[model samples]
Each structure stands twice: as C-alpha cells, then as structure tokens.
Target chain A: MREVPVGEITKVVRDLFIDANINLGEDVLVAFHKALEAEESPTGREILDELLENAKIAKEEGMAICQDTGLAVVFIELGQDVHLVGGDLTEAINEGVRQGYQEGYLRKSACHPFTRKNTGDNTPAIVHLEIVPGDKIKVIAAPKGGGSENMSRVTMLTPAVGMEGAKDFVLQRVRESGANPCPPIIVGVGIGGTFEQAALIAKKALLRPIGSTNPDPELAAMEEDLLRRINNLGIGPMGYGGRITALAVHVNMIPCHIASLPVAVNIQCHAQRHKEKII
Target chain B: MAEAKRIKTPLTDDVVGELHIGDRLLITGVIYTGRDAAHKRLIELIDEGEELPFDIKGQIIYYVGPTPAKPGKPIGSAGPTTSGRMDTYSPKLIERGLKGMIGKGMRSQQVKDAMRKYKAIYLGATGGAAALLAKSIKKAEVIAYEDLGPEAIRRLEVEDFPVTVINDIYGGDLYEEGAAKYRRQ
Candidate 1:
C-alpha cells in the first residue's frame, strides 16, 4: 500500500489553482481562435476578437482572465490501494484553497447562502470524491463561477417524453437563458440518471475539452444536433447578433430506472476554466 | 458594419445613449464598484431619507465583488458579477440619477425598462476576466459598507476598461438582436 502525504496533495492543489487562474488553457484558447475564424456574423467575429485580446492581456499581465475567480470545486479520484498519511485530507484541501486564493489574488466567492456574506477566503471547497481502480490519484480543479452555475437546471421526465422531449427541454433552457449565461456558451447535457446524479453528470460533462467528441457515436450525433439547434436560436457571442451562440454541446448518459428519464442542463460560459493533475 | 470605438469610462448619459447593443467600448474614467450587499444598504439609506456615501447622479456603478488586491496594486481581479441580482435596487438608483451599470448576465425586464425611461445603459464586462479587468482600474478606495468585505462599495478610477453595450436607451437589446441575426434558421 502506498502512503500519500496530505501536505503534498495540498501543495499540488494550491499550485494548480494559481496556474489555472493566470493561464487560459490551450484547448479553450484554440477553440476561441477557431470560433473567431468560423463565426459568420461580423459582430460575432468582433466579439471573438475582443475575447482573444482579453485573453492575451490576461496572460501577459498575469491577471485572471475574468473577475469571477469562482468557487473551488475539487474532484478527487482516490485509489483504493493508497492511504492518506499525516493530517486530515479534507482540511488540507481547504487550506490549500485558502492559500491559493490568497497568494494568487483570486477572488473568494464562497458565501453563506442565506446571509449572502463573503467567506473572505475561498475555502471549504466543494469536493467530489470517487474511489477508482489502481494506485494513481487524480485531482480535477474546476472553479465554478455563479453566472453559469445559476443557470443550471434539472428535471425528471416520464420515460414517454423520450429523446425528443429531452432535446426540447435542453433547447428551451438555453433559449430562455438567452445571453445571460454568456452567449457562445457550452451546453453540457446529462441524461438517464437519478435526479442529483443527472445534475452532477451534466456539470462533469463540461470538464470535457471544448469541441472534442464523445466516444459513443449516438451521443456524439446528439451533441452535434443540439449544438446546431442552440446556435439557431441566434444568441451570438455576448448575445449580439451572430451565428455562434454556442461553442459546443456535450452530453453524458447513464442508465436510469425504467419509469424516469432524468435530465439536467449545465451551462458554461466562454470562460470554461478547469485544470487537472495526476499524482 | 460600424467601426469599433474607444471611449473613456465614468460614462455619461449622452455617450451611453449613443451606444447600440453590439458596440465594443473601451471605457475610461471614474467608476464605482458595488454588488448586492452594498446596493441594499445604499437603497436603504435613500429610503430612510439619509445622505449616501457618494452621489448617485451621473455616476457609473459596476456590479462587482473584487478579489483582494495584492501589495502595490490598487485592486485585484475586479470583473463584473451577474446583473440580474441587482434588478431590484437598480431602478431606484436610476431614478436617483445612476447612468450606467457594468456586469455580466441579463437584466430583468423591469431593469431594462428603467434603463429606457432613465436614459441609462447596461454594459457587460467579461465575467471571468478578473485579473485582466484589474489592469484597467488604476485606483480604488472603499467608500461604504466596509463591513461587507469584498462586497464593499468602492470608488474607482479606471482607464480603458472594456465592456460591451448589452442594453441601450433606445429599447435595443444586444443579446436579443445579436442572437436573432446569427441564429441558424
């Protein structure tokens, strides 16, 4: 059995958080460049250009790409064969979040839900842990901002609503959201799971690289179809008139009870910020 | 297509009114920052017939809760937060002479209507570009609600702060208009 020191994990988490905030991921940057080129609307193209310029300024100046540094959401894939050594694992993660937000000058967004008071330090990360095969520990840091998160939705439909209903529901959510979630957004659809699981899967789907295809052929096709329909709604970049309202539509599916077809739509804005590390 | 123009911030009603939905604006001037908590207190003071920490007339209020500034910097990543949350308090401030709002996300119909009636405009700064946005803010000082921490009201001096005109005084909505134009038929 391998023993992993808690401090090591904390250090890694802290570094990853700082790095993710300062640098726009290459995949997201490349996707934005592609959007700029393929965007048919002059306004859309211009919006894309502004976004690119913002990114350049962010990188060059070592500034955050956008002001909403986001809530620290840590997804940990722990190996059954490995045991955490020395101090508490959860506390270590939270401490790391505090240090990272402080040192990096990232915003502390977490607050008491009812009081609406800022926590000062972006602490007590929303951690999702999974025990998987092998001895490798994988950590994915996804700093979720409030704008897109507030727009996320979940519904459990009767099996009879089927795929058509699912499609309509997803499109309707996006259309109703309009430019609020930040146009040219990425739609993450989670289908065929329990109520909460569906929501979680939908959010996890966003972690996928933009413009990448799902391995399943059927899921990939649905992604394409939904992407086409959402953009047709005419919510161009920043909701200014444009052909590229949505950058991509990603779907993740799981088996569900025969009586229910649960669905959740998680919207992610142009600043789809996430980073992962395997230790 | 119209050419993009660079305009100074602390934007006036005249300049804001001239902007359309899709116009890209490089803003400069004196802008203030406040979010939900600060807005509530400001409105409460106004309701109680008390003097505000700062005058609302002709001033642009950015809906933001900035990250704590690092040493030697005036402010941290100070980007816009969601605008919808400020829907309730905004119209009241507009009536008090508030001319502009900088934030992300959509405004309620009531807020949009208020913008039209008051000749104000809602500009959208990139939501997550906090660090980049900080570069534009040359100076910041907490003017009110210091107890609210990051949600405190701050008086700011900005230079070429970037924003897009999401809602205009002429009942024009960039979100609706832009989406309609490029939406696949």
Candidate 2:
C-alpha cells in the first residue's frame, strides 16, 4: 500500500479553494471572448465587456472575482491502492477550508438552513469522493455561489417522455431561470440516473472545462442542439437579452432502471470558478 | 450604445420620472447595502413599528453581501445579488417610498406593480461583475447588523457606479423588451 499523508490533502484543498475564487480559468475566459464577439444585444455585449475586465482585475490584485466567494464544493478522487495516513481526511479538508477563507479574505457562505446562522468558518465542505484504480489522489475545488445555485432544478420524468422530454425539461428550466442564474450561464444536464444520482452528476458535469465537447458523439450532438435552442431563448447576458444566453451545455448520462428518466440542470454563473490538481 | 447618464442619490420622484427602462446610469452618491439576512431584519422592524437604521425615503438599497476589504481599501469585491429573494420585502419598503433598487435578475410582478404604484425603479447591475463593480465604491462603513458579517447593512459611497434600468415608473421593462427583440426560437 502506498501511504499518503492527509496533511498534504489539507494544504492542496486550502490553496485550490483560494485560487479558484481569485482566478478565472482560461477556458472560461475564452468562452467569454467568443460570446462577446457573437452577442448582438448592445447591453449584453457591454455586460460581457465588464465581466472580462472584472476577471483581469481579480487576477492582477489576487482578489476574489465575486463577493459571494461561494460554498466550497470539493471533489476527491482517491486511487484504490493508496492508504491515507496521519489524520482523518474529512477534518483535514475542512481545516484547509477554514484556513483558506480566513487567509484569502474569502467570504464564508455556508450557514444553517432553518435559522440562517452563519457557520463562521465555512466548514464541512460539500465533498464528493470516488475511488479509482491508481494510487494518486485528485482534488477539485469548485466554489458554488448562491445566486446561480438557487436557480438550479431537478425533476424525475417518467420513461415515456424519453429524449424529447429530457430536452424540453432543460429548455423549460433555463427559460424559467431566465436572468436569475446569471446568463451567459453554463448548463450542466445529468440524465438517466436515480433522483439523487441525477443531481450529483449534473453538478459534476459543470466541472468539465467550458467550451469543451463531450466525447460521446450522441451526447455531443444533444449538447450542440440544446446550446442552440437555449441561446434562441433571447435571455442574453445577465438576462438583458441577446443571442448568447448559455455558453455551453454539458450532458452526463448513465444507465438507470427501466422506469425512471431523472434529470437535473445544474446552472453555473459566468464566473465558473473551479480549480483542480492531481497528486 | 448610448452614453451613460449620470445620476445622484436621494432619488426623488421628479428625477425618477425622467428615467426610462434601458437607460444606462452612472450613479454617484450613497447606497445602503443589504441582502437576505438584513432584509428580513429590516422587515421585522417595519412590522414592529420600530425605527429603521436609516431613512428609507428617496434612497436606493443595493442587494449585496460584500467580501471583507483588503488592507487599504474601503470595501472588497461587491456586486448585486439576485433581487427575487427580496421581492416580498421590497413592496413594503416601496410602500414607504424607497426610490430605487440595484440588483441582478427579475423582480416579481407584485414588486413590479409596487414600483409602478410608488414611482420606484429597479436597476440591473451586471451579475458576478464584483471586482469591476468594486472599483466605483470609494467608501464603505457598516451602519447596522454588524454580526451578520457579509450580510451587514453597509453605507457605501460610490462614484460612476454603472447600472441599467430594468424597470421604470412608467411601466417599461427592459428585460422583457430586450429579450423580445432578440427571440427567434
């Protein structure tokens, strides 16, 4: 067994969280420039311009791109052959978050659901862990903000609805979300799983780099079609109306029992803040 | 694109009357910041007939929860949050003559009706453009609810803060107008 110290995980998580908040990835930046050129609405184009400038300033000053700073959603892919040593993995991750938020001047967004009491330290990150074949550990920090997250939706359509139903559902969600999810948004569609699994993969789909395509030919075509229809909705950047409401549509599909066709649309704002590292 | 029109705070009925949906504005002067937590408390105070932390008449309230400022700055990255969350609270404030709201996203019909009734306007700031938005805020001080952390009500002094009219007192809706002009599907 290859022994890996948990402390290293803590450090990586801390730095990744801060970096993701402060920086905009190149893929997202490229997508922004493309949208800027294609956007026909004057206001929509202006909003895009401001967003580009915002990213540049955030990078130069090493400050967060948005004040929401977001709830830390960490994904851990642990190789089956690796043994974690030295400390509890979960605590170490939370410790990293606490330190990062304080040191980076990041906002603490997590809170009690009912009373709305602040957690103060931004602890207990929403962690998704998967075990794979190698001995290496991979970590991704995607800080999710409340505005876009609150607009996301999920529904279990009966199997009779099929592909057309799935497509319609995504369109309806995007239409209803309108300007609320911060358009030119990224639409992540998770299809053909159980209720909870659908939501999981839908969010997981967002981690894919923007302006990238799905490897599956069938899914890629669907993504292309959906992207076209969504932009046609006329809910341009910041919902001020234009031809480029959604920058990309990522679909992740897996087989499910014969009776269910669950779908979850995880909407991501323009910031699209995420950073990943393989150790 | 038209040149942005400059406007000052303490927006009165006459000043608000000249504005229309789709007009770009450079707002200079004071705006008080509040979000979900702070709005809830302000409503509670209204219901209880208690004094508000600041005068609401003819003032704009920005829906935001800003980050902590860096060592030399007055505030950190601050931008508009979604307005729908405050829909319920807004009508009550507008009933008391609040002039404008700065946020990102659609307002409820009830809120729209109140704006029409009260001559208030809803302005759209580019959502997620926090760092760029922060450049206009020259000063910020927590005026109330300090324990709410980011949700605290802050009095911000901004210069050339950019926004576009999403709704106006004359019943114009920029969001609807803009979308309808572009929808082909």
First chain TM-score for all predictions:
0.98, 0.99
Candidate 2 on A1-279: residue-level lDDT in tens?
899999999999999999999999999999999999999988889999999999999999888999989998999999999999999999989998998998898989889999999999898898999999999999999999988898888898989988999999999999999898889999999997788999999999999998787999999999999999999999899888899999999999999889888999999999899999998
lDDT of 1 by residue, B53-95 (tens): 9887888999988877878889877777888889999999998
Q: Indicate the TM-score of model 2.
A: 0.99
Best by TM-score: 2
Indicate the residue-level lDDT of A212 in model 1. 88
The native-contact fraction of candidate 2 is 0.81
lDDT (10s digit) by residue, model 2, range B40-136: 9999999999999999999999998888898999988898999999998999999997999999999999999999999999999988889999999
**Can you tell me the CAPRI class of model 2?**
high
Q: Best-fitting candidate, measured by DockQ?
A: 2
lDDT of 2 at A154: 88
